[model samples]
Target: MKITFLGTGTSQGVPVIACPCRVCKSDSAKDKRLRSSVLVQLKKSNIVIDAGPDFRYQMLREDVKLLDAILITHSHKDHIAGLDDVRSYNYLQKRPMDIYASVRDQETIKQEFSYAFREYLYPGVPVINLHNIQQGIRINGADIEVLPVLHMKMEVYGYKIGDFAYITDANFIPAETMAKLMDCKVIVLNALRKEPHVSHYNLEEAVRVLEFLRPEKAYLTHISHLMGFHEEVEKELPGFIRLAYDGLELDIPNSWSE
Candidate 1:
């Protein structure tokens, strides 16, 4: 399995409009981020988690040619805003994009992109097949497990595929959900900043979760400008943990257990 970090920034993304924070102004490429998202390429599957506002550019930058499915983590604009761009794939593949999401997020998608769902829609509208994910789903020979977590007051879902798990936009994870993460070889969690926040995990809180989970490799994503420079913050992380940047890729062996 090959995992790609498409984007790693918070909702507004790095270099927020009209803002002049040091981290935002940094010249390093690592500091420049799009919204948070990732693409998971399995043996015979290509799936993306979270479309976000930068979906179009992320795909273009990566020169992606095939996308089998998309998994939505939540209904937030930063996560689903760019879903409309899937029309490009619809045109190229001649098939409806398979979209997996909770019922609540499906409602949000319907409201946000009513034109696409209209019975008599335009020919160019994005074509999508919505699948409500309650327990788990199977696609292209891979089984996915949905782990529920909390994003402030709203409930969100994290996904576990083989030995890799991804959880973002989450502030609190229930004990049961934490248990679901057991045996994961790699985990990607949100770490917004050093200071605590109401709707997202701070660096310390994320680190604590990593310590408890004890994944062989842990990456922090969904970063904010307040998180400080990537290099500086990375120096403070444990040896096995690293800051994920756009375009970062990791190759995982077929074995789910190490």
Candidate 2:
């Protein structure tokens, strides 16, 4: 499977409105990040993890032709706002895109895009098949399994597919969920910034999680400008862990090989 990092930045992204921080001002392309999102391609499957604000550009830049499904982490605006953009894929593929999310998150989508739920309310609003995911229920066709997590008290989900796991917007994963991710060969997770934050994992805490989970390789994403230079922060990480940048691709072998 080829996993692509569509966007590596946090909610505000690297360049906040008019902050003009050095990381934002830097000419290096890696420093310029969109919101958190990823595209995973395996065999004929083209699944996206999170549909952030940059959904259009990510697809166009990658020349994505068709998308089979979308797996949402939570109902946060940054994660689900670009959901309407799936219309392009729906038109190209001539089928409805299956969206998998928790029941609460599905509610958020219905409320946010009321017209999409009703056929007569608006035309061309995008047709989507909603699958409400209950924790620990494995979807057979998908190589991935949904691992529910906690962002503080709120329930969020991270996905484990084959030997690759992608976890974003999660502050903590309980002992059981952590065990599930241990099966991953390459782990992609959110590491907000250098300092601690209430709702997200800071760099130090993220490192601890990495150590315990012990994936062969770990890449930090959902970064904020406060994380500092990409190169500089990366240098501080252990050899097995690196910072993920947009368009970064990694090939993780199936766990059967391990």
Candidate 3:
């Protein structure tokens, strides 16, 4: 399995407009992020987790020609805003994009993109098939396990595919959910900044979770401008943990491969 970090920044993205922070002013490419998202490329299909506001640009930047499905982590605008842009893929693939989300997020999708659900759809509207996630689901020949975590009072989803797990926009991970992540070789968790956040994990909390999970490798994502320079934060992390930047790629053995 191959994973690509499509966007590693938080909802507002890096270099928040008009904010004069040193990390924002830095010229390094690693300092630039475009909201949080990931592209998982499997042998039979390509899946994108979250389609943030930068989804279009992310797709264009990566020159993606075929996308089989999208797995939504929550109803947050940053994670689902770019969903409308799937029209481009619809045009090219000549098929409705398969989208998996919780029932709550499905409601948000309907409310936010009401036009798409209209009986008499307008031309050029994104074509999508919404599937409400239960415990887990299969798509494009891959089975994905959905793990529920808490984002403040709201429930959010994290996903486990093969030996990889990804969680974002979360602050509290229940013990049940943590159990699902035990065997994951690689895990990605959101770390909004250095300080505590009501709806997201701070750097320290994220590291603590990583330490407990003891994954072979753990990456921090969904970063904010306040997270400091990527290089600086990276230097402070343990050997098993690293800061994930946009466009970072990792290749892992596909257990399903024969």
Identify the leading candidate in terms of lDDT.
3
Q: Per-residue CA lDDT of candidate 3, range 159-243, in tens?
A: 9999999999999999999999998999999999999999999999999999999999999999999999998899999999999
| TM-scores for every candidate against the unseen true structure | 0.98, 0.95, 0.98
- Candidate 1 lDDT tens digits, 1-258: 899999999999998988877888899999998999999988787899999999999999998899999999998999999999999999899999999999999999999999999999988999889998986988987899998999899999999998899999899999998888888899999999999999999999999999989999999999999999999999999998999998899987766421
Deviating ranges (above 4 Å) for candidate 2:
135-140, 256-258
Order the numbered candidates by lDDT, best leading. 3, 1, 2
Each prediction's total of clashing residue pairs, residues at least 3 apart in sequence or on different chains, is 0, 0, 0
Of the candidates shown, which would achieve the greatest TM-score relative to the real structure? Answer: 3
Q: Model 1 scores what on Cα lDDT?
A: 0.93
> lDDT (CA) for every model shown?
0.93, 0.87, 0.94
**What order do candidates take by TM-score, descending?**
3, 1, 2
- State the weakest 10-residue window (summed lDDT) of model 2: 135-144
Tell me which of candidates 2 and 3 scores higher on lDDT: 3
Q: By TM-score, is 1 or 3 better? A: 3
